[model samples]
Target: MPTAKRPPKPPPKPYHHGNLRETLLVAADAVLAERGAQGLTLRDVAKAAGVSHAAPYHHFASLNDLLAAVAERAFGLLAQALEQAATEPDTAERMLKINDAYVACALARPAQFRLMFGPLLARKHDYPEFKVAAERAFGVVLTAACAHDPERGPELALTGWSLAHGLSNLLIDGALEGLPIPVGPGEGLARQLAVRALGVTGAAA
Candidate 1:
């Protein structure tokens, strides 16, 4: 008599269904928020996602790939926020909205923020998609800046970007609060002064 054999069991899936890429990115984001890029690892993310250690490889070949994905998501969100901010009527008002939007986005998503702007993941040039996404996000601010200063559009865009980038960096690093600028309802006094220096007038008198 011959014995019958049973088929092998199917492999288990990752914790989340339908969107493993997003799950890995979310796990990576949590690692970034808590331990930063240096401390992040594919194994750690896999563990966080309750998947096999090699499961991440199905979506991201290496840690940098996962990181680039994180950056791409961040840039998309930033572009949307800035675009919305720039929609305000007055140029100054629009600029102010953009300024606030940048900082708010960073604060709201610190992990994504660090990945987008922090030096820890400084190999941005190596990732073309990440670079393109970054440029898209920056273009939002540049457009608003140009709209505010048509005569010197390019320079104005750079100036506004510098000011907003520097301010966002400072706020993220806790340096803005220590600045000597006035606070409270006059919270944006420094930003107003900087915009004026770039020849962009504030809202109507």
Candidate 2:
């Protein structure tokens, strides 16, 4: 008598989310918001995205890869926010708007902003997309600064970036509250500081 053997199960049907990459990115963002960068994991992202634990591997080789993607997206958003300031007819106003946008973006997404600028993710060479997006965002500021002062454009751009970045970190860490600035709210205070940093008083009128 010969024993009958059952056929092997089909390879578990490779979990298919219609837009898995975007889904994973969205899931990663949510995880970042709730758990911060240290708590993020491919498994957690997959679970959040409603997919198999191994699904993230299809799009990301490692946790860093996933984080890099998230950073890239954050930079793109920051670039868009900065670009909005370019719409102002006046260069000084535009620079001020750009500074405002930088702080606003960081405040709006503290976790993402931290991850984007954190030391652990400092290896820009490892993430070309992130590098490109970051450069584009910086370029917006540089362009606006150049418009404000052609001779000091490059120097002013760096200064403005440093100022905005410092303010963002301060605000996010709650260090700005202790400062002796007479402002009604955190946003207003940030705007005022940003304007002064850029030396853009034209918009003040």
Candidate 3:
């Protein structure tokens, strides 16, 4: 005798406790990780989220809006990581650790990292929340840099951030796989630079 048909699966709820907005953001982040920014769209996010195509519209006005929200979430997470990384009392060592945290956070969420810096979203200036989150994340680094040198804090922060960002991308893309030096987030040249910036040298470095 033929077996009876299996029961149908339940449809996804439109929102869980009025959290479709967060649900959409989570779905968008997953889609971006799985398929990159080019593949992130409201319909796709809805499909991934197991929600109706119209569900995303109820939360995000447009793809750019969703993208900004996703980026904003990433920046918030990065800021938290940076804040926690400054635990060591030694300021120079703390700076390096913060840089390492920044790199590690990027490596942990490479897709989000790219989205945070990519041009797909409308200029961050147009998105107040996005701008605040980005600045707050950057402020962590700036705070450390300014403490290292009040006269040149902004420039130093940019230099350090640029180094960490480039290093993260290189590692994420597998470009640093064969380097002869022992690889690390902020152990070598990055550490040296951090120490030098604070005028720490030799054994202290």
89-130 per-residue lDDT for model 1 (tens digits): 898778767776776777677667867876624777888888
TM-score list, all predictions: 0.80, 0.88, 0.82
Residues 1-205, model 3: lDDT tens digits: 9999999999975454368888888889999999989856789999888888888888788998899999999999999999998766666666788877888788789999999998944499989999999999889999987876688888878888888888778877988777897665434655665556545443345
Question: Which parts of model 3 have CA positions greater than 4 angstroms off?
Answer: 1-17, 120-122, 179-205
Worst 10 residues of 2 by lDDT: 181-190
Ranking of models by TM-score: 2, 3, 1
Q: In model 2, what lDDT does residue 141 have? A: 93
What's the true lDDT of residue 83 in model 3? 93
Q: How accurate is candidate 3 locally (lDDT)?
A: 0.81
State each candidate's clash count.
0, 0, 0
Higher TM-score: candidate 1 or 2? 2
The regions of model 2 sitting more than 4 angstroms off are 1-14, 178-184
Q: For model 2, state the Cα shift of residue 35 in Å.
A: 0.8
Assess candidate 1 and give its lDDT: 0.75
Ranking by lDDT: 2, 3, 1
Report the C-alpha lDDT of model 2 over 2-51, residue by residue, as the tens digit: 98999988786745678999999999999999999986789999899998
